[model samples]
Target chain A: MNSRREFLKLAMAGSTAAVAAPAAASAQAKPKRWGMLVDLRKCIGCQACTVACTIENDVPEGQHRTAVPVYELDGPNGPSQAVLPRLCNHCDEPPCIPVCPVNATFKTEEGAVVVDAEQCVACGYCVQACPYEARFINHKTGVADKCTFCVHRTSVGLLPACVETCVGNARVFGDLNDPESEIRKLMAQHETKGLRPEFKTGPNVYYIGLDDRLASTVAVGGGARDLRQGLETSAHGEV
Target chain B: MPAVDLMSFDHEAVWRPWAVAYFLLVGTGAGAALLLAYARLVRIAEAKGALIVAASFALASGLPLLADLHQPARFMHFYLGSAPGSIMWWGSWFLPLFIVSTLLLAFMTGRRGNAPMCGGERMLTMIVGALALCILGYTAGEMSVVAARPVWNTLGFPVVLILTALMSGAGATMIIDSLNGEKGEGRYMLVVTGAATLVAFGLWMLTDTNLSTLAADYAPVGLFGGFIIAGVVVPVVLAVSAKASLLLRGVSGALAVFGALAFRWSTFNGAQLMSKTETAFYGHEAALSQDALRTLAGSAGLLILSLIFVTLLINLLAVRASKQTQA
Candidate 1:
């Protein structure tokens, strides 16, 4: 009984310290910067990541959780193509978060923008607010749903469904805060670009070998289009 | 005409007509309800007429929305969950509340005996007022969410919707009050009508100056041209002036209704034109590319003609109904 009391006392002290230490340390710790890097040069458009993502998440048909927009570029000699795997950019300054009247959607400390499915009323407002078409109404739940970046898998130290199944090993994921991480190393080595950077969404996903010329082809306020020369150059260079 | 691309024929792509119809109907309903609620609060004699108009508007708004639904049978799904995050969800809940409260207020007032309003009755009326404001605000927010379309993506949208509803409601009350031979209702009508017009004009001018292209798409020829002058400025001027007779009041009320409908229609048309133009002119062409201009002209023509026809029909019916009620 004495030993039990001592154990209980130690456990209480441990719990109090655990709560207090984080509160103190959080003030000192720099905000964690999270990001993703895609090596487009290595991406073969095999679509292994796309299928894997759907199966793992049970994404609905006709509405994709993630989409690979295939841009066909006409060239001097022949037709070439470049594929951009479009998903939630998980923007640093998320537009969708502020518009939710009920605070059903919000950003996490890890910088992932998540929606509370229970709180969502399935108004389709967030779907329209997303400039990149990242969100879609889950037909089953009748609520706004999108890529969670495999939060469940990532928490368990497992790769995202997409990253795990990427055939070309094009997608690299890691804690961007860790200097030793592969993502950090690759980002350090390469100049990266993001879609609609002018919107200043501060997207975490970065692309290497992003055809700047092709990106420029997207007219201001106009939606997507195909660029012939840029795609040919990118495809030829990659092969 | 450009060869019609049948493969990409999106039923969802044709959003303007539906959006305009929805906005106009909802605006009218919200406006009529506010007028009735205010009349009841103030213990006005024309409260019964206003209540009837409010109920009519609410019922009219529901028709278009029901028609717009792909699966009308599943309409009850909106009420199944208290989805506060969605404007439509909140609107669905609030609209019914407003309708029920308005019915109860109408019932209480209809009783011939001199019975004082119960505490529950007063509380319910207050709740209806608050709910009506919410519905107005939510409708505006719903429109503003279409960020890709610059015309609909303004901070002014929700505020404009509220003001428009108030103006529409006030205009509706004036017409009903005049026909019913209520004394001094015309002055109240004139004041609200003038204020509503000024607010509508001020908001349009502010929006025009800030977003020039959006203004061009909406008011095209100038402020004096298109629906603004015909629907808002003219009606307001007529309603305010001393020469404004009962005939003039009827004309002004008709104009106000027309203006509200036209404004909504123009907004819907402008958004569609802007998107189509942007899609056609992308990177390779000038901002005002020939193809973009053509699309704009075609869309504007279609929208304006449709408005004229619909307005004429609604006004003819309304005038006839007012005459019969008076007789």
Candidate 2:
């Protein structure tokens, strides 16, 4: 009984140390939960973000890192164009991370999901796993590529290329963990919605004034999509 | 009434026909390994043909898979680390081990010169059989875990893959038996498996709303019909009727093998063609580029060569057995 008490005391001490150590470390700096907030009502469908993102990431022609899909929908007034800017959600419970065969894709320390290109086998498993249709196998490099949430600029205390170029100030990005962050403020004020929330992916990217049909799936292919596809195929047949 | 898409890029399928070929060939190989285990257990003389199909197809199955990978050279990354959460990572480990154990079983003869089975050979067969089951499970889990692809996400997808693998492997073994003039036990197994696959798929359609909806909307009449009739029904009919000529046997065998290929093409590749955001499919562009052709050629050639080598080995073993009996 004496020996059992001694063992229990040792176990209790170890558990306390384990709990206290992380708390002490966290005092220095708590890890940031990065997030994006898109205010759809503010967007003008300029395609500036698309063009800027392409230039910033050096994305190939006919492929997208991020693209604004404009849908023609009938509202309370009449038919008007509505835009849903699509990009990698970089979800808290990212489906893409766990599906990677080689453990090449992972969430960074600050909570942005990124792929290690050098280590990637480019099997396209993650590409298929993504519900957002955000990831693609880079035709030039033959590796999985997606929006990194502009980690390059964000880390250096600069806005993402897309955010910087948005004429309407639609794309608001910041650390969700920070109470004073612009994104947190907007999210507090507005009823923000995430795309494909039915999948329960816990998307870090949230939106305001999102249409119900646009959030789920859009009925397409009887309009400009067919013509665009045809022309792209025929025009860029060699590539 | 409908939302018209003014501008959207065409999304190409992440996995192409190369993926379909890999799945079909690998699934067939795993099933053949299972058949080999059963044959060895029952003291069947036709184990070598099953063994050959199992090892050769498993051996050659990696190429198309590598081709499917855009960076085939980086395949070593699969082994450098381990990720338990990933079905694909689990598959990477299961695949190599399965191949090695199968090859070991093939090299160590089961019944030599009509002798009773040796002890080690029996143990190895069981191991190979167990590993074969792992490979089947791994392959099914790898695809079925994709919640994004509604057709593949169903429980029935794995069942159909497994059942089809069993019958297709049986078909392959039967083909070899007919070529060597041996009465194949696979003929009977095929009828059972073919029927099981049909029932499983029918139940799948009824129970799973996602699959039922997808099938209603876009299941191709030609490819899907070909899989049901030519692959399952025709082959099942031929196998049940006894006293079939060698020509018919070979034809059915070929059809069965091709049927497995057709099923993967129509389902695995077909599922990728469907759009998640848009109602209509992102139409298939069937690329016959130099890269695709080269990859297919390389993998198919390896498969052919392995088959030839196994055939010669079988013939040599027969001659040696005859000499021993004469002595």
> Which candidate wins on lDDT?
2
Ten-residue stretch with the least lDDT total in model 1 chain B: B3-12
TM-score of chain A of each: 0.76, 0.83
Candidate 2 residue-wise lDDT at A103: 92
Q: Candidate 2: where are CA atoms >4 Å away? A: A1-28, A229-239, B43-45, B110-113, B209-219, B287-297, B317-327
Can you give the TM-score per candidate against the true fold? 0.60, 0.89
* Model 1 agreement with the true structure over A1-239: per-residue lDDT tens digits: 01123334545776587667876476427555556678888888777877888899898665666656555444566655566776787898887776654567888777778888766655455665676667867766767788887777766546778887877778776667656556778888999888767567788888898865334223222113213213221121100
Per-residue lDDT of A12-47 in model 2, one digit per residue for the tens?
Answer: 676587667876466427667888888999988889
- Fold similarity of candidate 1's chain A to the true chain A, as a TM-score: 0.76
lDDT of 2 by residue, B1-327 (tens): 778778776678888667877887888888888888888887555477688888878887877888788999999999999888999988888788877887666655522645566888789888888888999999998889998888899889999889989888888988887887877667777788889988998999889876665555445442456677889888888877745676677677777886777677667655787777666566644535564576567767988987886555555665677688789
Give candidate 2's error at residue A31 in angstroms.
2.5
| Candidate 1 backbone collisions, by pair | B31-B169
Instruction: Output the lDDT of residue B132, model 1.
Output: 72
